[model samples]
Target: MIQKNKYLIGVIALLALALFTVPCLAMEGPDSIELDSLAELYEPVQFDHIMHVEAAGDDCSVCHHHTTGTPVQDENCIGCHANSGEADEVACSACHPANRFQADYLNKIDENYRLNHVDKVGLKAAYHIKCMGCHEENDAPTGCQDCHTRTEAGDKMFRSGKYAPKGGNKSRKSGH
Candidate 1:
């Protein structure tokens, strides 16, 4: 009887330790992440995830919405997701579609009448909205160049850098 009791206590202690330690280990995300989903135009953003985590005071919900099991902080979201627990996947792209406006994706959204997030933003817009909003509030760099450097394709599209039209604004007379 004494041996059985000791073994039971040992199992219970191990279970308790695992319950506390596993979540903490899972919460420690990568120190940095290369955000390259929109790399077609801009260079991949080297996001300092650890810094942002610290800045957010370890609250994953600041950027992760209600996916991290944290109570929703946004007044707009709290109504629907106050108790919506942790999601199976926490990646942004898992929920926000990369090609949000694609016909198939739009059709799916339209077909799913029960989907609560009918107006969900695309992946690119999600990053910009969340990052820019927080940066603005924290007085961090909010300029495009601060986070994204345009690629050659982007420069050409904007007609900037070397792609800019030559000649220093010399007015040309139109021949009638």
Candidate 2:
């Protein structure tokens, strides 16, 4: 009876984890997002999700690879993708600093921080490397306005695009 109870509990635990994590992972991230991280350098840029995925031949792994992470360490997609600056104890920038990697950036690390990428790069560097590198490889538009545009209309225009995820609805029944 005890063995049966343990097995049942284990099943329940697995079910709970699946239910919890699945919801978090459902979206293909936001579409037409105006970046707020480095608004000072240039006008806020809008990101088009559907266009990029289509350009990449429908392979989600190109960007979502952050979820699986590099060989050295495993990180949840939410950890780096969102990287909300509003909250205390943020994880992204301490390791991936906004400016270049230096002793100053390393000094900011929390005691429990885990170093994942073999090459140390900052949050700014990560965005530029991934987005620009892909564009350069594909010979796609790399113009300043081509990727992102100024959020001149104000916050109202940020998520105005509302790009739908695969399957057409939140159920994600259509499948990617």
Q: lDDT winner among the candidates?
A: 1
Candidate 2 weakest lDDT stretch, 10 residues? 65-74
CA shift of 97, model 1, Å: 0.4
- RMSD (Cα, Å) for all candidates, in order, is 8.2, 17.3
What lDDT tens digits, residue by residue, belong to model 1 across residues 1-176?
A: 99999999999999986676454333457888999977987899999887887798767888888998877688989988998888888888899899999999889988996877989999999999999999999999999889989999999999999999988799888987
Cand. 1 TM to true fold: 0.78
- Clash numbers, per candidate: 0, 1
What TM-score would every model get versus the actual structure? 0.78, 0.45
Model 2 steric clash total? 1
Ten-residue stretch with the least lDDT total in model 1: 20-29
Top-TM-score candidate index:
1
Off by over 4 Å in 2: 1-28, 68-96, 99-104, 108-118, 148-176
lDDT of 2 at 18: 62
